[model samples]
Target: MKSFIILPALASLATAHYDLVFPEWRGDSFADGASQWIYPCANVTQEKSNRTLWPLDGGAVNIHMHHHWTYYAINIGIGTLEPAFTATLTPELHNTTGNGTLCIPKLSVPAGLAKEGDNATLQVVTFDSFGSALYNCADITFSSKAVDPTDCKTDGVKDVIVGAEAAKTSTDTANTTDAAPTPSQSTGGAAASFGGAGAGVVAAVAVGLALMI
Candidate 1:
């Protein structure tokens, strides 16, 4: 019985991961693809602007994770410019394996950051205990109006209890037979991505993760 229980714990440790799932993503892409992380906005060529205009005040962004991590952060910047500030969404989150929604609330645009009709990028980064950082980006437009505090607070939030319970339920159905892949299976190099055309931008984070530090 002890050996049987230890097998499940090891399985949980090997399969934890996170993905970005909100703001519709700039490129109409999935977070699991390495190409999505290569640019400030994923699939830049497909759409220069996201039809959805994000609120300046009290805006909520959402994420999904199969595992908990040490730190999670979100940074917003105008166009393809590098982000200067970021909000630490979660500091030292302890649970190692749980699938649910993660929400970052009250996203306030900095003064003089951008005006209405401007293109912007929102980058999400998370650090795991393995010392590997996961990254994702969303391309969005700035909304002219601010959101009501009351509505914004409750509108997009998911119930923590429900999510946690659901994650636990799925564990039994999850495949535990496959062992973690060996390092030899790693892709030898990182993904190469460009920011905006003529901006001479490089997808630094994508490049780093593909190399799997």
Candidate 2:
């Protein structure tokens, strides 16, 4: 009976979703995992008073992934209230494997997106292998002092491959060469590689926790 009970609990942990680590979460969603599914900010309507000071040029975004594989998209909204997420920070959806601390250092802020002393919100959307979408966000204040790149590090994570959805979109675009390009495609956005910023290197760090589950 004890063995049976433990198995289900372990399974739950193994299949858990991810959490935004850097900046800061709007509220505590870890206690009730299902709440993370709530759209646009995981049901956390109010922003916290203590916002993280992100670099005006760009900064790091870190997350703790529970799934062995997941897809991620990052976006930014400029404002103090109900800011519209008008900018996508990711060039394409990132497909990552392994489960632990995953960090993207030096994610470049688009030109004129925001300036120092502006309050903005950083949003991270994710999809697991099961195709479930989860949302998490961090409230930030742009600052001239940049975050140290060394602060961003991974414990157990790796960029496995191009995201399936992104790959399909690329193929579809190629097929429709004459079709008008989407705003995202036209911008030539940049994607910050996992583990290091813009290195474009696939890396796998040893798992730190005894149980990834």
lDDT of 2 by residue, 138-208 (tens): 88899987564466688799864443444456547856897765656533322223322222222211111
The estimated TM-scores of all candidates read 0.48, 0.67
What's the alpha carbon RMSD for model 1? 16.1
Clashing pairs in 1: none
How close to the true structure is residue 100 of candidate 1, measured as C-alpha lDDT?
A: 65
Q: Highest TM-score, which number?
A: 2
| Model 2 CA deviation exceeding 4 Å by range | 1-14, 32-34, 47-49, 160-213
- Which candidate wins on lDDT? 2
TM-score of 1: 0.48
| Global lDDT scores for all candidate models | 0.47, 0.68
Q: How many steric overlaps are in each model, in order?
A: 0, 0
Tell me how many residue pairs clash in candidate 2. 0
Regions of candidate 1 where Cα sits further than 4 Å from its true position? 1-14, 27-51, 80-97, 145-213
